[model samples]
Target: MELAISIIVGFMILGAIYAIHARDILSAVIAGGIVGYSLVICFLLLKAPDLAIVQIVVETITLIIMVAVVLDSSRVEAYGKFDRPAWVTAGTAVLILAILFWFLKEASAPLAPFGENSMRMADAYVNGAVEKTGSINLVTGVVFDFRGYDTLGEATVLVTAVLGVLTILRIKGKR
Candidate 1:
């Protein structure tokens, strides 16, 4: 599992590098999506399906917006002079992101192995949540009943983001 995560992180690193140096906006957006989706895989492997689902949905929405913006405007290369300060800033940001990811991995190391959970509450939720909530699916029961308000907020945010993207695209189409 460690090997798998390392490989995925390696790919993410490559994607980030490509995104930073990509000549065209579209290729950069695609490379950025690679990094985001790679994060979803890492979250899944770490036994955090909730985080994985959130990451996947957010990443998908972001990728869609980025692609739409790129396609709607310009096909030209995104760089202008590519100065030394830009390189330094990009490098610093990547370094910060890498350090944060390292801390996250270290912090989660003591938790259960990949695809396994150490929490007793998880078992209780899985076993009896459906019966209590009267939902056919365990996931539905947990999300809609147990975590109702939280789920509602997340859904609202997603809907708002998508609607914003659609509005932007529609406005661009009129011109």
Candidate 2:
């Protein structure tokens, strides 16, 4: 698992560099998608299935949209040489990643390992309120019953994105 995660991270870093340095818009979009996919794999390896699922779905959609935009652009440039100043892009990305990893490490370092207590509560919820909530899955019970508002907000954001994209497409066609 660790080796897999390390490989994913290496790919992500390389993809970031390619995204910044590759002059072709389509290549840059693909590189960005690579980074997004890497992050999704990393999240899954870290045992965060829910986050991984959300990340994969959202990132895939985002990448598709970006690729569509790049395809629609009139100017199609060849993939150029790595022309960006390497130091600037690499340093900034590394610094940002380091800070983000540091913060997550600190945040998770103090978390208690899951044990019987969590299981017992989950079982209790399942046995007690599963039918009442009309949710056969305990995870759904927790998400909809406990975090429904957050889900609502996420749906709102998705709706907003669709509207924005439609508006932009319309404007693009007119001009």
Candidate 3:
């Protein structure tokens, strides 16, 4: 299992390098897709089947969107060696990868599962406020009762972000 994870991680790193070094936008996008696929494999090997499925689906959508954007632009150009000096690109890539590898290594410490907390919290909410809130579903009850206001605030923030993005990208008069 450890060896498999190491191999997957290697593939992910190589794919990321390929994506960065790819000249064409479409090729870079394809490299990104490969990276995502490799990540899915890593997730599966780590016993996260659900996350693997979700990542695969999201990666497919992202790849399609990137392809569509590239097609729309259609101004592909290839550069010869030393566009900004190969040493600079190589140094920057190594720096970024080193930082990322450090973060990942530091963050992978063993953590407790959330199921115990969820179950306890659900029990408390159900028994304590069952009649007050008139909610039966434990999960919904906890969210809509205990964290209802927070969820509403989060939704508002999300809506604002979407609106901001749309406004920034909107064509005012014409292209």
TM-score of each: 0.58, 0.56, 0.58
| Best candidate according to lDDT | 1
- Candidate 3, residues 83-150, lDDT tens digits: the string is 68888999999999999999887785454443234345556666767686777655566667788998
Query: Could you tell which candidate, 1 or 2, scores higher by TM-score?
Result: 1
- lDDT (CA) per prediction: 0.87, 0.81, 0.80
Better of 1 and 2 by lDDT: 1
Candidate 2 — which residues are off by over 4 angstroms?
A: 1-3, 49-58, 74-136, 168-175
Error of 1 at 168 (Å): 7.0
How does model 3 fare in lDDT? Answer: 0.80
lDDT of 2 by residue, 43-159 (tens): 887877888899999998998888787787743655555678989889989999999999999997766654323444666666777667887666787778867898899999999
Per-candidate count of clashing residue pairs (backbone under 3 Å): 0, 0, 0
lDDT against true structure, model 2: 0.81
Question: Which window of ten consecutive residues has the lowest lDDT sum in model 2?
Answer: 113-122
